[model samples]
Target: MRTPVDDFQPGFAGRRSSVAGRNVTILFLSALTIMAGATISPALPAIEAYFADTPEAAILTRLVLTVPALFIAFCAPFAGLLADRYGRRKVAIVAILLYGVAGVSGVFADSLFTLLAGRALLGVAVAGVMTVATALVGDYFSGPARDRFMGQQAAFIGIGGIFFLTGGGLLAEFNWRAPFLVYAVAFALVPAILAFITDVHRPEALPKQEDRGLISGFFLTIPLAAVLLASVLNSLTFYLMPTQLPFHLKALGTNSPVLVGVAIGACTLASALFSFFYGHVRRRLDVSAVFALGFGFLAGGLALVAAAGSFAAILPASFLVGSGLGLIMPNLGSAAMAIAGEDNRGRVAGLLTASIFLGQFVSPLVSQPIAERTGYAAVFGLGAATLLMAALVALGLAGLRSRRQPA
Candidate 1:
């Protein structure tokens, strides 16, 4: 079975030494996508208070954390299309520049609306960064190498989340705007991206009728739909930590932003640790079984969150949630990439990225009103129940697959 890497071997034959640098650069770029939303999560309450005079300040302030997701969801497919038509490196460079400018623009905004506008642009930038970066992983590697890189990529993003979330929390203690300064780090990565990242050359286009049929068929496949749906659900539930946990903690008598950061960082720390071992885990379990295991952890974690009485209790809960995410992240990427040919890898990656953020964007929208009416515990409880059901469905699918296989 010839892999994507085999096709490019001659071109890369002399560039073996550069592979490490390329992988590192792509991993660094992956961090930026998660940073788009999670970094400022601790500042939500402060932003809400600062904008008390604004209409619907409570909802809008939460949107400040999630609004970029909305834009990323809407714009990611377009970004992917551009990357597929043009080239990944050029799109990535431009996106990284936009990310820096848009990210920092929040620090200067005097109004909630302006801050959200900046966040929306940040989403557009994230769409480009995330889509191309994932596509590059598919372009550069195949088989076990791709699987290993996906795990490493997820682990790196989790590690980045710990730093940004903790740093943002501490900064929020000083001023809500302080966390926005973290966006400036995107600028530093531009030089590395230019030096190390190279775009893959796409094969010649198929005939128009055949191309359209193949692309349409791929999009409509059951496996692809399942992966996309699972990605959306996984993100929607995982996002509850950042969007709702701080307020939940405050309601439980923990009001410090630093503590809030630490609580959220616990989740990222656990995620990083578990993701570091994802390749080993994947070697033993099929993707459906992995999903079952991951969602089970999430179900257990959210249940703990709903029952917690103190801030300390949230740490263990966060760790459980992170473990689930650690597995699910790589599984989603690997599954989607497995189905993607080089011609549409960018579009597939873009769609998957969009689904993940779409869930993030929708998380607050779905959870907040429920929390407002039923309280935070009820919201977490309902999420736990939903995830539990998902876990069972995945287990059943795994069982069905096994039964169909020959002894």
Candidate 2:
């Protein structure tokens, strides 16, 4: 966007650029992005049971988990604008503080509606933290450095997802309220952020030659549109495990939260492992090829899930899906960064974040009806079909682009 100028900048030096300090802070905060929806996933069945007497309890209980995603989709773009106008550090600090407060408030809510309200507030908090955290990555690093850093960050989030989902399952074994305690961890991040993280540029100032037109131009490009479309479909299918797997496990004759958590957590673990090596994968493959590989794995995994008869089968299926996500997540993020310059990084990151969560929010809506009619297994079949189509589309597009390029 800055007229193709050199990517590096003369950033803040001294303690502000201490790699270890800032990386630790950002990695810790990145975990919060997963917390918005996944932390409560292990307890979904229990929550539904608690409110069983209420009208439409099944749907509303699922809403309790996904409602935050809906709010995040709506609020993140505005949050990005705020971070751009205000300092990123300031917005992030406030957001983290609110995240803890709203996240923990779920423990004391007397009814489903009260908890829904708290979840909605948690979404607003997540929008700010997520947008600012990703924008900071762009602000702090560039080129191959940025690619490696994004992969590392994706690994952290995947690992965090594993921890939170498994811990939530164990906590739900005692009571539904117990998992809310994990939200308190956000409070500990505040001081660390204040001491370590610093803004890369002055608030509201654009780098030279980084015209507003270029920002708009980048957003309208075909590559960005393809990345976002793939991201949306990928998220919608990936989320099926988290949002509906518990119910599926229940239908399979096991109601133990630990087993359900382990089933879903397997995907996260695989994703983390793949993300840790994403840099190596990226060195050999272009973005579209990576996407094609990812979707192919996703398709195969979903097919396995659709036919799965036991937890053992689901475990391997989850791993395959996770592997695909590992390939897709970091590449999509870095692709966004490649298109955006510093001036619009926050806004672009916000839009990307919004697309991801919006798919999550819609996952249940799309799956619920099919699940209600045919059963949960049908949902996986649908996901498999969707992902297979996506893979074909990606590969075809890649072939076309390759042919069009000058040799």
Candidate 3:
């Protein structure tokens, strides 16, 4: 990978240093990343009961919430190629429109299958929205500025999650359909994205790598691969909160959607708080060090969740997990982009986005059977153990890298 020194040099062309409307638009779009799977989380049980007659309602109801991740995982790579070949703004605008349409389509869905179909379309839209918006971020910023904005982007997404989750909970109190209305907010952003977002020129072919004056594609692939692997593991565990927290709360005898939302929001709010300070955290730690801190907190937090006896006890545990995620999210993106060829930034961002969501889609698949056997609390315990292993691996790798480098 290239040093920070190489990243900031003039060879890499990007937007000006000053903040602009385009930055605001991309940040707003980032909020939708969590919304894809989480906004409907607070309503999962209600939907299941509402569709009690549907085949496999217990599982399919959850699929209505999670299926978007599957679609996004599959479609994001194509979305990236489109963003690269076509214009980023054009792709984003259409995606935003589809996001609103497909998201709200759930309000009229009469069966589990229909809802899953709508959510599937929503996934395709989100793939376009997320991939293009992220690629645009890389196109428009470099070095510390890119790092700062990515941190801000994650923070904003957390803030959005607080709003969406809490709002969905309160809305779910009335009807599961109400929360779907929140997706229509994307339509309002259409004008702003059109007005402010512009496409960066992408070359058809990359330099021969040697002339590029950066790490070879082969060497750069190593860290990118590592980052993608971490993305999958991080998301697999990170998602337990949103996907299982409602049921976990239900098990503890708290059934209010509003309370459920608030419980989930506690984690997101903490994530926002930590994410807002991620740039400061980055300055003090290397990428591997930051990842280690993240996984360590994640492990400890999940362990606490497994042992917590009541709702109040779970809040701080969730916050620790959130903080770990806040620290880890930006580092993964920044690390990948740090080594990516400028021409293929869109494709790379797409792959990263796909990996993250694929992990999310797979989480319930892996966790459900475990939860059935050991209960939700034990599910968290298992996740914590996995995260502990990840933390140890990261720490070991960082030590190895340190030893290989000059003092």
Runs in model 2 lying further than 4 Å from the true structure: 1-17, 207-218
What C-alpha lDDT does candidate 3 achieve relative to the native structure? Answer: 0.84
TM-score rank, highest first?
Answer: 1, 2, 3
Clash totals for all models, in order?
0, 0, 0
- Off-target runs (Cα >4 Å) in candidate 1 are 9-16, 203-218
How many clashing residue pairs, candidate 1? 0
Tens-digit lDDT track of model 2 for 186-241: 99999988877777745545654554431444564687777778778988999999
For candidate 3, report its TM-score: 0.92
Looking at model 2, which ten-residue stretch has the lowest summed lDDT? 1-10
**Highest lDDT scorer:** 1
* Candidate 3 C-alpha RMSD relative to the actual structure: 4.0
By lDDT, rank the candidates, best first. Answer: 1, 2, 3
Tens-place lDDT digits, model 1, residues 306-347: 999999899999999999999999999999999887677888
Clashes of 2: 0
Each model's TM-score?
Answer: 0.96, 0.94, 0.92
Compared with the true structure, all predictions reach lDDT values of 0.89, 0.85, 0.84
Question: What would the per-residue lDDT of candidate 3 be over residues 256-307, giving only the tens digit for each residue?
Answer: 9988888888888878888888888888777898899999999999999999
